[model samples]
Target: MNPKELALKAITDVFVRKDITAFDKYFSKDYKQHNPFIPNGTEALKQFLPTLPKNFKYEPGVITDHGNMVMIHGRYENWNGKNMIAVDIFKIEDGKLVEHWDVMQEEVLPSQSANGNAMFPII
Candidate 1:
């Protein structure tokens, strides 16, 4: 599989399944994740990822590969409970995800939702 496809699969199996050991197989030990709630690094991710409610979806957009680095745009929401559009940047080093950066906002339903704009960067 291509780097992008492999990355997506890793996310699906590791994150969705809450399999911490998957990181060793699919991600680099130096993996760095920047997200709203999480601090940093794979260890932090291992701690935070499992705490989130199940069924959080990752709808990856066109994965643009800059050689080994890939930029992914996706929407992450836990069913009807909460919604957030997330921007995740993945860097593949030696075929494994070595770095990750992400940002997310609470979904804003124009009139009903409390948060302002769920879609960030309006990209």
Candidate 2:
């Protein structure tokens, strides 16, 4: 799969579907994570996934690819009792994800925004 497709599938399988096998399929053994809350490596992610609240949900939005990197803008619902908006960036190599980075913030309701702009596009 292309980098974008790989990224989407990886996120869907691991985060949305909670498929542990997806880690071996989509990620390199030495996968590097920039998220401080999670340790480096696919095994660490596998362990982390099951600890999430059962109501946790991931909603992917706009996605873009540049070279071997893919960036997905998404929302995490019921994450630690609050919703979050995040941009997840993945680096693909040899048909697998080698590295990841993310920037996340608590999602604010549209009504709370001074300009009333949504964090994610309204598509």
Candidate 3:
């Protein structure tokens, strides 16, 4: 699969559809996560997903594909009200996601922005 397709499948299958087994199909065995709080392995994420609140949602907006890597901009709406705007980068090797990095900021409302525009263009 191409990098963008791999990224979409990884997030949509696992986080959106709640299909944990998709990790085995989309992620490499040596997958490395750069997010500090999460451990560095596919197995770690597999173990963590079920622990998330039922209301947690990942809504992807814009995607930038660059050959072997893809960057996704999205919203992570969790049950705790810590909605975040995030940029997730995935590196693909041989059709599998092998490395990941992410940066997130709390989503700002239109009222909070000087220009009154929401952080997510899709919303």
Candidate 4:
């Protein structure tokens, strides 16, 4: 697979599926992840994958590849759960993931949650 495909697959198939072996095949042990949540290393991914609700699914809208790096924009949906708009950035080297960052926000309407006329910008 291409670097971009491998990177996304690592997250979707490996991390999201709680398949740690995916990391063994796709991640560097020295991987460093920068997220508002989640720790560093393969173990962080290992621990985090299971935290997501099993019904979750990501609906990708955009995937921009810049050489060894990729940026993904998507909406995460669960049938009866919260809806999330997410943006994730990934850095890959030699078909293995080395760094990752993401921002996930709950979907809210003009008068429902925050963001309707919120002061805090979506960063």
- Candidate 2, residue 11: Cα displacement in angstroms equals 0.2
**Model 4 lDDT-worst window of ten:** 114-123
How accurate locally, in lDDT, is each candidate? Answer: 0.69, 0.93, 0.87, 0.73
TM-score of 4: 0.74
- Looking at model 1, residue 44 earns an lDDT score of 72
Q: Of the pair 1 and 2, which is ahead by lDDT?
A: 2
User: Which one is best on TM-score?
Assistant: 2
Query: How well is each residue in 66-114 modelled by candidate 4, as lDDT tens digits?
Result: 8988887767776238777777788888778888888877766557755
lDDT digits (tens) for residues 22-54 of candidate 2: 999999998999999888987777788899999
Q: Give the per-residue lDDT digits (tens) of candidate 1, residues 1-123.
A: 677876777777765676787777788877776665555557776776677776676565555667777776666677347767666678887878977886666756656656654453354
Clashing pairs for model 3 are none
Query: What C-alpha RMSD separates each model from the true structure?
Result: 4.4, 1.0, 1.5, 5.0
Point out where model 2 deviates above 4 Å.
Answer: none
Candidate 1: misplaced stretches above 4 Å?
A: 79-81, 109-123
Between 3 and 4, whose lDDT is larger? Answer: 3
Kindly provide the TM-score of model 2 when superposed on the true structure, using C-alpha atoms: 0.95
Angstrom error at residue 29, model 1 = 0.8
Q: Against the hidden true structure, what lDDT does model 4 obtain?
A: 0.73
Q: Model 2: clashing residue pairs?
A: none
Candidate whose lDDT is highest: 2
TM-score attained by model 3: 0.92
